[model samples]
Target: MAEEEKSIFFPDDSHKLWSFGDTRTYQRLSSNSSGFLRQLFIVNIVFWAAFLIYFVLTASQPFAVQPLLLAVLLLPSIFLSLYVLVALRSAERKRLKLRASGFIIYAPLSQDVFNEHCIDFDQVRSLRLALHKRHFLPEEECLIIERRDGRSLVIPFEEVLTDIRRSDFMARLSAYRPGLLDLSEAPALPGEGGPSFTELWLHDFATQGTRESLGLLPAGGSLKEGSYTVDGIIGGGGQGNAYLAEGPNGTVVLKEYVLPVYRGTRLFEDLSARFFAEAKLLSALDHRAIVKLLDHFVEDSRGYLVLEFVEGPSLKELVEKEGAQPLSTVISVGKDLSAALLYLHGRFPAVVHRDLSPDNVILREDGSACIVDFNVARELERDSRTAVVGKQAYMPPEQFRGKPCPQSDLYALGATLYFLAVGQDPPPLTNLSPFEDAAEARSKDPGFAEFDEIVRGLTRLNLEKRIRSADLVYEKLSRLALKRRES
Candidate 1:
């Protein structure tokens, strides 16, 4: 006595049968009443009647020939009709069994039992609804079961007059597979049919609304088992949003991948992997001049990186508020940045900050500089699939073509320094040397003379002539700082 399993029936006759047991749930769908089947039957009748009329009008042979012709023409229709009947009957007989172990789809053919499909619970990734419509069929809903390894199975439902059946189905599904259909925290669903990357990117920025309205979790939302509470959204870009958060330890910054819509695409997968790797790399490095990664986690299909909260405005903000800084402060900040870059590049497999711009550098209250936002950093062993990503003004020519190296970072660093010195963005790189501009800057401010040589060496148009390593730049800046102190 299984305690007389509870049964819920759809009053609208949308679902053929549904039974729930303590250990399992069962569902059977009717296809005969489907809009698709009825339309198909009507179409077949129309075609058959038309053919009969045409044969009666055009027949020149005996009446016996007409029967043969009709039979020949109608064979395919008969076979199709039989297929539809059998399919509908089979669907009505099919039982979807849900157990703690997994899902089993079973039906009987003749005297033998047929298990059409069985899926292990571990392989199940998510379950969602898909709207499918065909020639004669009205728009119908199908339950789509998505697997972790990127496979899917679609189960069509019977035509129900109300949505109550769908609601019941979802409720039962959630009860059986609690988190499977909860895709809010799952990574983006993978598939190919969506808006283009460029279109999505444009839409993300062009649209204006609050963080929650734009699909971002609002401030005060708890994350990582209540370990971190979001303070507010600090910044965002094409890939993700950065939030200032507070935790038990102290204040931290959380960078979360916000593009849930791109989850199943190759681009989403690639970027997600890179984001995790970046978190790992940042966590391993120990430098005061570099933002420290505290932890990383995946929530609601979105990846997040927890970083140490730097308590200061970004260099870009500082400059915008208070024009150019003192030469000594500029030189000190440059030297600190160079040291951070040296540590990154000195690794066995050098890390290149592909998107080094003034905005990426933060100025502390004590006048020290720390490099933040390594979203586009990559190892020296570059992959062919790496896309060119960075600010146009800061990116070197080689970087624009997807070939970034230590020299490319150097060019950006020089450009950043130039902006700091002149209180404005540098002109686009052409045949004109940045040194010529630096020379004019030196005439206005003598401290620029000290950095003119360094800036020129670092921002050379030709890669062959540019300063080769961050270490070398650091060393040169260190000497200049020492010289300035001595004088």
Candidate 2:
């Protein structure tokens, strides 16, 4: 038989037997093989009949077969014929039916009770094809359906459907559920062939495998004269992704700035320049409570910053896992962060961390805090017409009017502290009176009373009335810390 004869059977215009009500059936038929099975059955029957006749004629002779020998010969031929017949019957009954709602597979030879398996489209998350290479024939294809809950169903196409019919089925499936047909193979990990298209699609494009594919430069790959190798994406935001990378000194956090929308635009160039400037400022900054920038480089039109990788959860994560912190712990964290901010303010250019919240502050294992995510931080002497940025709930009143001084960062710290004490985010600035909120927070826990005056000083609505500098805030928190220790 021709190779094409074994492929899936598709009905033509003249052959209208496939449809039954609203369902369409497809089958692989041995009937198309030019009477091969029928011929074999006839030949076997004739040979067996002749042998039985000869045996009967010679039954009385001494050379004739014994009863036991005759029984053995007859049983073997009968069993072989039955086996072939069963196979022919099974081939005739096997089929796949497709309906508007779902698909049904029928296999009479299998142990299934009803000899059928039905599947609904809604259970499918993705559909992919696997190819099996053959030495002397076309590659065999199998369809894999991955469900949303992680179960997978494999449907083999071998001797089941024709090439044309399989193509039609795939086309229909794609039309019914676009983006479900995944043509790409399973992706390799980093340092293997890098990530494949399937990995990029399945992952959120923030893992180690998909960095380069997402256009954020590759992790585990070298950068900056082979001094740093990105490991994986630690976190991500609207601006870019931050990666845990390895450097000559030790592990560092690599921040890559790649804005898809700003590519090829003047805004991209401006932001890139600002990113470099920030890197330089961070490299110069050396403080125990601040993430240190070790090195920086620009590659493939993307800016990269190598920063100190703090090995601890952010304050946000800690608060979420362990609810409200002890007042003493909160005071210590505040004191450490305030000192870090004072260092920034005391710089010659006076850097201001425009966006400082619980998420940006890492709580080290030793209970100390480190400030991170300086992507939006700006130098006081540069760019007066910068756009407003920072979390709205934490922004000072002047920040809403596009003027953020050192006091603005102090307000954010107050809001962050309030969250730590109250186990909830403070109400928006418009609806909130910082002093009243602080007093109410203190009322909840007597421990918060010592920090109420500090919170009020930091979060005062008027810029002039707010904490004058990070230095003063640090001094106040230090005194509170000292008092707690004495007790």
Candidate 3:
């Protein structure tokens, strides 16, 4: 027999019926209760008594009440009260479903009140709890959800209370988006009702105590309607910025591409289209040595790419801390990078990583290298527009002229290796000769000469003299590493 799905139901007497299941859970709110029925009965009696008194005072005949007249007057009042009770009960029959990605508020009778009933975690801007009380009735509490598009959803809090002793309904809501609900209270006059604590929390959370900001997004701010929360910037360049963020999939690097062109212009549209197309292509790639592209989007007239976060330090940081790397370490990194490039270049029509540098290579904790930063990458095509992109020191002559080919990446790789083998950057736009600068490597490894030859060939000024492909580069590095191991 198939095992029954495990679920926990709230206590029988609770106004809310909460059921927790494996894949789906829901909180059902109903207004029908014995207490409400008793209240209604009492109200009907009082209403009829008031009507009888009014009729007697206004009657022309003294000490006499007509049964037919009384029946006609009280009938409408009874029907009106029943209609009101039905409407109120219908309005309270709401269901809150907790989905994997977000939550849904289902109010079949009160659907017209909200712009949207389903809300993703990213769509939420801020949440607030407010209490409203009138002259003689019990206080009513509501949860107000403010969205990014200036719309709001007000959910009654009374029926949402579950019988769970450990956690309440609001606590469950908070679990959906950690740190989302601001526990702080918003200052307000005793009777004011329009504004709540959400506005104050949002204002402080976005500003971070600074009136003026220098970056495109604040540290605690979110993007894509709150899907990704920015922790802080990881890196930035002339064209874009990269941020380390917390997302549904855990830590991710958010790369923002800033297009200076005005929105709605031909240039802007063209740029945006190309960016998305390239992003789509990149997202299809799966390689252990390459940082995976998780997602991409455009918001506020800027393009953003979500990439898997590499756990280890960049090659640049490694070198900065340890000075020049050992010959074996350099060879391992070279082979890994070459393999990654081969995978990219082997794609149909070819994908050229126009930017490759020590700063773009991250060494994993397991010592394998992962190539990152595809902001300037493109599919190989001779007729494509030339955009001067990449660091000057690592960029070759062709790349500086905005005409990078697959070999342009080889040159940058050579420069990166040169920085690792020797403790400094090679001169830009010049052929590299490692004899004078690689004494430290030579002292450490006897096979440094062969490695230097590979670097020299890769950084050659003439295209004909440069190393041909990532395959060839990988072969050469493998041989050098093998020889070192044998020796």
Best by TM-score: 1
TM-score of 3: 0.53
Error of 2 at 233 (Å): 1.4
> Each model's TM-score, in the order given?
0.55, 0.52, 0.53
Kindly list the per-residue Cα lDDT of model 1 for residues 1-487, writing each as its tens digit: 1222322221122222234432223233432333444645775897777766776688775354555666777879867765665565455434464433455554432222122355666777877656655335566565567888898765554432132233333433443344466434323345635543222322332231223334666878898799999889888878778899998899999987753443233354356446645765786789999999887765555667788898898879988999866667778888998898889888868888888888999988888999988877877874333478888777778887777887888888888887787677877663223345545546665545657778888778889988998888888888888887787
Q: Per-residue lDDT tens digits of candidate 2, residues 1-487?
A: 0111111222221122244432333333323443434645775788678887887787787365677876778768766776765565454434555433345555432221113445566666777767744334455565666777787755555433522244335433432344567777633234555433223221221111213444555656777678888888777877777888888989888887763332223354355445645765676789999888776655444557778889898988998999877787788889888888899888876888988998889999999999987777977843244568888878887788777777888898888887787666776573233335545555655545567778877888987778889999988888887776776
Residues 1-487 of candidate 3: C-alpha lDDT, one tens digit per residue: 1112221122221232222321223232333434544655766888888877886799897458877877886778777766666566455645455432455554532222211145666777987667644334466665667878788766655544422111223333432344666545422337545422222222222223222334468889988789999999977876678899999989999987665333223343345434544565567689999888887665554667788999999999999999988888999999999999899889887888888999889999999999887766878874444668888888888787667889999999999999988878889987886656878668767888888899999999788899989999999999988887787
RMSD of each: 18.6, 25.4, 22.1
Off by over 4 Å in 3: 1-215, 237-240, 258-262, 270-274, 383-385
Name the TM-score of candidate 1: 0.55
Q: Candidate 3's error at 414, in angstroms?
A: 1.0
The candidate that wins on lDDT is: 3
List the candidate 2 regions with Cα displacement exceeding 4 Å: 1-219, 224-226, 259-264, 430-447
lDDT of the candidates, in the order given: 0.66, 0.64, 0.69
Sort all candidates by TM-score, best to worst.
1, 3, 2
